[model samples]
Target: MPFLDRLQHWAALRPDANAVTIGAERLSYAELVDRASVRARELAGESSGGPTVLCRPNGLAFIVDFVAAVARTGTVAVLDPGWPALQRSAVERMLQGAGPSTPPAAAPADLRDGPSDSIFLYGFTSGTTALPKAFTRSRDSWQRAFATSAAWFELGADDRVLAPGPLSASLTLYALAETLSAGAAFHTLERVDVGDALDAVAHAGVTRIVAVPTVLRLLGERGLTSGVDAHALTGIVSAGARLDGATLASVRNWAPGATVFDYYGAAELSFVSARRLRPGEHRTGSPTAVGRPFPGVEVRVLDDAGRASAPGTTGTIFVRSRLVSAGYAWGDDGSAFARTGEWCTVGDRGHLDVAGELHVEGRLADMIVTSGSNVYPQEVEVTLLSGLGGAAAQVVVTGLADARRGTLLVAAVVEESGPDAPAVTRADLRTAAADLAAPKRPRGYYRITELPLTGAGKLSRRLLAAWITEGDPRVHRLD
Candidate 1:
């Protein structure tokens, strides 16, 4: 059965159980099913070929509508509610003439006959480009993801999941579905507020947190000051980006009793490699080591010839699993996902250790070949962040076209905040980056007021690359 059917089953099993909560509002399993049924009836009434665009902010309304659309087999496309008006308008214009018509009535038969292979979601990839790529997911793909996450994360009915990011983000959206499918209460904020999240954990008995590392770091910092009972948090899952050792240790210090997990995955490829951050597990191998493959998922580090590379050799990372998406929908960029026989790649460059642990270098397009050596910006950034201690606030390493070296490795630093913010110089950064090999260490350094960030709070390397190539007023040369 699909996710909604699983939810209905849970509703039948636990009608009065709390299904979802957002601040003061709470929905029991019965109420959730009823609301979704009403919404599904409305959606079923609609003409169903085209996708259903869910552009609303995160709340009970979005959840109900999403579930209803899924149940009615209307391909649900989630849009970032915080998208710029111009971008939103452009997408709206492109979709205006192609949307489905209204149906006469909600058909109950439509719900029962929907096949697992049928497309249910229109997920957009988070990119820095002008337009995002839309990808389709069959019910089975997400259903498989639900199972894998439940098993790997060891989720249960007793767990109360707190997903603090926007629901438009696939990580949080999958967390919502996974929480419901596991018959657990799902909690989220309409917008992420660290104070509100802490309150929920302290007062509302939120047991698990599914969030990006950046949000986790903020929560950890607050938890240190505010004093949250670590025992209240059962598990914390960090996704969307890699967590540096310092951030991981801070979160561990705050939630010592909770099992902290960080997974490396993309929207197109669901759950990939995941690792637990215990005390001694911090410095395992490479900073990029993201742990072993998820349950029932197979990964390969293949060279240009499409053969598996030797362990520790970087290559194109290919995934073969039912959890992969049904491929791109509208904007099949042709660069992201490529198929070779049975396996497919999402353009990520990574490798497997001799022990079979996956270590991600960076995105294939993001790799920088400078001074006759290939440098992964993530490796350089990780080294700088770790070596600099608290000196480096935020660091982005991007390659700029250079006349001498072909590509110049530049490190942009957002120095620590405050009147006593350490006056870091290019010399200091060069000395701090000594931990990295000669080739990987950044040659140029710039102290900036702010690091360019995506709307989703991720480091916008593309924007930084642009700012480096074409001068930006925000940047200051640290010569």
Candidate 2:
């Protein structure tokens, strides 16, 4: 069943149960349905059943508006609330111009029986230009993903999920939808606050947390020091960026009862692969391993010629699955996201090991060519985060212009802080990266107070590069 199709069932089965919670505000399943129905009627009366723009901050209202828009129009565009005024206006203009010109028939009274193949979501991905690229997904794709991810993670009606990030982010939005579809309670913060997130896990009976690695790290550290009880947390789902070994260790220590899972996915491709680390189980394999393909998904590593690459041979990663989005709605510059027959690739380069585990190197656009050798920054960043043994809280690798080597590989690290945090130095980082090829190693190291992140909370390599190029005072060079 589609996501909204299950809402009525949940409302009937658990009318008084909390369906969505943000901060202190909450709506029961029945209340959620009623509010959404009211909003759906309001939406139908306001505009034609065309695309609707949702640019609100994380809150119960955003959730209600999203469901209402989806039920009424079946097409909703989510924009970051933190976007600059100019960018927001530009995106709104683009969405307005791109929507259907003719008005569709009146919305149905039920509002929950839209066709499965109808496009329900329009998500934007960070782009090279001033405006982000918009991508659309059919209701069927998300319905399949909701089922697959819920089953994979063992989410059920008894679970209370906390996704403490902006709902505008795809990861958090999907978490809310997946939890609601499973007839479970969903919790989030109006603004990302570690104290509030810890309180939710401690006092709200939150059974699962779905967030990016950065938020997870903050919550883990704060929860540990504040003595917040996380025994109710059964699962920790990390995505949007790679989860470093230190953060994973801290999260395990903080939430000893929960299993930590790190998944690799993109906005265009719903879910590619995931790996789970059971409580008390230490990761013992390749740092880049992202586990097997998700159920109903086929992964292929294709060389430049489009033929499947040999095992352990790095190539462009492609996916064949029903979860793939219906391509871009607009802002397609052709720099990423392409298809060959039934296989789709976003130019992410990776390889499959002998055991069929996928290891993502990095995106082709982020590859650095230094001294005639190609280097993927993700591999180097992973090496620093995992190989350094809790020495760095975060790591970002980028390339700077050079005279001799085409590009100079550099690294910016946020050193682990606190009484027990390990002491590290430039020499230690170099020694730890000995396993990497000489060309792949970072030639320069810099220290920063914190990792630069985008509006969505994912680490922004573009911003880090800009910082280095502009000689930002926040970034301090290390000898």
The candidate that achieves the highest lDDT relative to the unseen native structure: 2
Question: Candidate 2 residues 350-451, lDDT tens each?
Answer: 899999999998997788899999898998988777677777888889888899998999998898788888766888889878989889999888888887
lDDT of candidate 2 vs native? 0.84
TM-score of each: 0.89, 0.93
Instruction: Tell me the lDDT of model 1 at 205.
Output: 92
Candidate 2 backbone collisions, by pair: none
Q: What tens digits encode model 1's per-residue C-alpha lDDT throughout 1-479?
A: 26777777788899999999998999998898788767777865664446667898878999988877766445677888777777776665555434333233454433331468887777787764477777878888987788778978878998999998888888888988889889999999868888999989989998899888778877887888788776788789988888776568778888887888889888888878888755334455777889899888899998988788999898999988888888876677668877777788888998899999998988866789998998889888877877777886668899888999999998988876568868777877888788888999888888777757665556677778788767888888888
Query: How good is model 2 by TM-score?
Result: 0.93
lDDT of 1: 0.79
Kindly report the root-mean-square deviation of model 2 from the true structure over all alpha carbons: 2.4
Report, for all candidates in order, the number of backbone clashes: 2, 0
